[model samples]
Target: MLRHFLTLLVLPGLVVNSSSSRSSSEEEKEHDDGSREKESNGHHSNGHGVPWGYKDQTAWTFNFTDCSGKSQSPIDINTRRAIYDPTLPPISLEGYDLTDDSALTLWNNGHTLELILPNTMRIVTGFDHEFLAAQLHFHWGTPEVPGSEHTIDNVHFPAEIHVVHYNSKYANISEAASQSDGLVVLGGFIQIGLHENENYEKILAVITDVSIEESNTEIPGFNVRHLLPNKLDRFYRYNGSLTTPPCYQTVNWTIFNDTITVSRKQLKALENTLKAGQEEHLNKNFRAPQLLYGRHVLASFMASSTIKNPGLGRMGERNQSTEQSEGLSRGDILAIAFGVLFGVSLLCFLLYTYQQHRKYTSITKDPRQNVIYKPAMKAEA
Candidate 1:
């Protein structure tokens, strides 16, 4: 009897061990698949990363038809002159206010200032750009580094705020989102430092009241203009797509080279906001850097001139004098003029022949005789 009982126990143990081993293997496989998806160069079997049909838990989806050829993505900034009429209307954030219930205000409170944007703002003259603020969001790292998205060049900041916007005069956000001219996102990089933002403090004061499960807060009489950088003159512009899922390829991203200052307190507030209901302490919020997507980045000096270069890599300190001229070159202009002249000459020749035909038709009226008549008096000479 004792031997039989021992055998039974051993058998159960063996079965349990085998099952556990299989479960672990399956888990590892799933993890590997996820890693591969993330590391992929914006390509997926279901077109998850590319600008095609894909959807996620968030209400966002990717469909290229919705994007514009000149649609702004996260990195790309297209330069066309924007005509602004000061007399037409001034954008007012007067009725806007922030509270624990306001999602945007909550984000700003957490030192992710770049995320909460105004619906309308100022327009820059030569850049042909206007400010439209979208929702606020964050990206972070594991406990070791603590914050920010890791860039392709292996550079990382403390945290980044993406203030998304669209050119409303053209179309609504959804319609505009798919075009190259569709969206414009202003990116502000935050670094952990000693200086504290007073505006951020008011926001952080109410973080404890906001819920974790995507809730909205009401902030009465909020003025969004105060949150922007005072020196709007300097910024790095590029053409890139959305960094998040549905990774829509329509965005004109303007990343300010100037890093905003956030206090350690503000950073902690953001960490707390992210930690609302997680048991395992899910701290990471950033998506890994994406492929540069064969785009060029341009920089314009508010105080000086515009600098344009290939968007393959980072910017360099080439003097304004060293920059190459853009648009139609001298040779191109000459070619265009010559083409126009040729077209005009052809048009004039056709007109002269039409007039001569009309004159001949008026004089030569042959009802029965299908013969041409020459002037008889000329033969005598």
Candidate 2:
């Protein structure tokens, strides 16, 4: 009985080291009501290229056919439900490192800041067909709200970076955008890190140059590969359409499982720097997560059965303790290890104490059972 009591006490300590599981928020309560369907290219309601904003998305279905497609992009990736594809190869990039010999064009297309890349850079390896890197852009929100387009297990991150590419066989991006496997976009979530990133700074440094809509500027070239997560092997892949309209359903999406991090200061700059209209700050430019409609979300690596939402607090804000959540640093794992060791040591001490108490109780009641008496017979006298 004493051992049982000690065991119960020790169990709680072991549980203390366990990581916290993500709670399902109201976002999870949202279900696919089968309203997301197909559109005929969305020219009637809004008119092609007229203009749309994130504030209104229900109107997208009325204008574009593919916008209401069953396999739309930016779907909530339920990590536990993702299917593992062992055959999926590690994403390989070619000619991503750019020297500042020639400045790259940076465009403020009214929605987001875009950095145009040379076609020489490409996703040469990974899929059945090669893809040429076209341009990369970001989707961001204000400090109060996280503006990432794609979400993980219904949990939103501070921002998301998308590197867009087009199928190489096509003459241009337009020709490829119509095919089933025409475009491949690499997406990585952004979270706060311990320090500012020099790689990301290259872009943010010149953000003010083109603050207005329909503006363009040239920024010094830098290694574009550093913007993405280092672990290219782990990713979530699926066939989905573009988040923006005319929502083309021809993209092969590869969302990195491991997120990249920038400092809190850099994050704030991203939200406040760019402008969409004359004075309106360009934030929350991302569309809401669309329904999956039974589309399979594939994984390049085997995903954990459990889904944990660390780093993010309520309303998808970063918690101070885990602000630098770039896939658990060495310090975090070590802390967990030390916590488990301490719990085990305490359990051992409790077990030993319980045994000593039992011995004392038995001896106190029946002293003869444990105590050997020396006979006091003075036979020698």
Candidate 3:
């Protein structure tokens, strides 16, 4: 029963901990104290210990359940349908440069770039949108598992990086989140493996210095361009809310299907930074799942296009090719059939066992009943 529940509720790549070091009582005390501090300071706690009035009124809530009813809920990217957005601004690396000063600025301010959009980057062939680079931050777990708010197909990866970007065309992050084209977040999922990531190493090298609790430090000269994957052609795009509260519903989420590789050593470095008090304790800084409102998740390149009447002719041609490729892949269908069969067999077995037990109980209660055999004598006569 526990296994069944876990299968349904937990993401695949997440490591489940049976015991958390901090006592329930102590945790409650800390929570209460934190709440009081927020009220006293006239700043609301987003539950991630991020005080109000910090960084444009953004608060961080550590747990997911507390984020209910907000515009953003951590969505399972794998489950969402991918659609082609011809309107999707083209992302290019031309003319954009990363400098040590930018890196240092990021490190010093404790502000990470979410998305780096330069004026030169085009969304489509002819149309362009000017976007500014913002900092990227992570929500993660301790040594055992990855810390990510959103899941993919109800599965969690080792880590999820949110590359937040604001349309300089918009006023601010919050304001941008309010408009359809205000914010664009590129989500990169990471897996724990033997492969080494040089770019990740560069970022990890400086994470230790700015990791002080609740203290925001900026790393100077950090350029956001270094983190992008070489290939951005295939991705799952959707209209969803932010994964954190005041869960703004105005985010254009583009989740890449491919996962980036990060070394165990690099993962450990991040875990070390998020550790709770007392070296022995693990930092379980994950939010719970939120309600899936009556929202339809549209997919593109899977079957049909979700975006209505996309204005580009090339996009339509591309969609047809993608759909054909997906149709040929029978693996996903086969897996689903097998899973259904297994579930049905398990259910039938349980039902049969239950009927047998009931019959045995009935017989046991009437054990004294016995019948004499007289049929043979009558036949012989």
Best by TM-score: 2
**Which candidate would rank higher by TM-score, 1 or 3?**
3
Candidate 1 TM-score, C-alpha based: 0.50
Return the lDDT, model 3, position 110.
Answer: 17
List candidate 3 segments past 4 Å from native: 1-67, 78-90, 93-96, 101-103, 106-128, 216-223, 275-283, 289-291, 294-381
Tens digits of per-residue lDDT, candidate 2, 1-381, equal: 233222222222111121132111000000012121111111111224335666788877886565687877779988665655666777889989988875787767666777767767899788878887767888888888999989998999999998887678865454455565566788899999999998999988878888877577878778999999988888887777667765656567889989999999999988997777789888897888988776666666654442233322212322344334424535567899999999999999999999999988887899477778898888785
Ranking the candidates on TM-score from highest down gives: 2, 3, 1
Cα RMSD for candidates in order: 22.1, 18.4, 16.0
lDDT of 1 by residue, 188-228 (tens): 67767797876656555665555343233434324444444
lDDT of each: 0.41, 0.67, 0.45
Q: How many backbone clashes does candidate 3 have?
A: 58
Worst 10 residues of 3 by lDDT: 22-31
> Against the true structure, what is each candidate's TM-score?
0.50, 0.68, 0.56
Q: Give the per-residue lDDT of model 3 (tens digit) for 19-88.
A: 1221000000011334321110011243334343222322344332233443354565533233444454
Clashes (backbone N, CA, C under 3 Å), per candidate, total 42, 6, 58
Q: For model 1, where is the 10-residue window of minimal lDDT? A: 22-31
Give every collision pair in model 2.
37-68, 39-65, 40-65, 41-65, 42-63, 42-64
